[model samples]
Target: LAKTTQPISMDSYEGQEVNITCSHNNIATNDYITWYQQFPSQGPRFIIQGYKTKVTNEVASLFIPADRKSSTLSLPRVSLSDTAVYYCLVGERGQGGYNKLIFGAGTRLAVHP
Candidate 1:
């Protein structure tokens, strides 16, 4: 199984674009990489999921390499309100939904003035 690692904290000014990268060196072949963004008091929102190549939606974009060992999340024109924790989870989507999900310390993103 692949383990993910990301920045413990990051700071950015409002209106700046931010990119966070996660490394999963041992990612499995059937695993799906998912990215979630969490607010201070709210549950995480699904930002994007990708197996390979790139996936883009209204919230963010996920870029996965062919090796499937890492991914990047791009947040465009972020604001102070966007400050939150970002998690990169790599697991079996179908089997893990019913099981308890493990979380990392999480990357705390702080948007500044």
Candidate 2:
């Protein structure tokens, strides 16, 4: 498992674009970067996943550089409702004899009016 480093907290106003970067210096070659968002009193929800280059979805975009040492999660025009704790996770693609996935403390994002 790769160790993830991310901001403890971030502040932003409504309708602003927010980019959160996570660094995993020990990331493995077969590991994939995955982001999840968790709102107050709710379980973490999957946001995006990527191996390399860039991947975009209706919710967010993930940018992984060639080295795959770090990844960025971009949220477009974020609103107050988007305020949540975002987690950066790295894990193997297949079962590969690994039965559990580990998550970090998470990045707390506060969106204001």
RMSD of candidate 1 to the true fold? 1.7
TM-score of each: 0.91, 0.95
Q: Which stretch of 10 consecutive residues in model 1 shows the poorest summed lDDT?
A: 94-103
> Candidate 2 residues 35-56, lDDT tens each?
9999999999988999999999
State each model's C-alpha RMSD to the native: 1.7, 1.2
Error of 2 at 9 (Å): 0.3
Query: Mind giving the per-residue lDDT tens digits that candidate 1 earns over 41-96?
Result: 89988788899999999988899988988899999998988899999988877774
Question: Model 2 segments beyond 4 Å from truth?
Answer: 96-99
TM-score of model number 1: 0.91
Any runs in candidate 1 off by more than 4 Å, and if so which?
A: 95-100
User: For candidate 2, what is the lDDT?
Assistant: 0.92
The Cα error of candidate 2 at residue 54, in Å, is 0.2
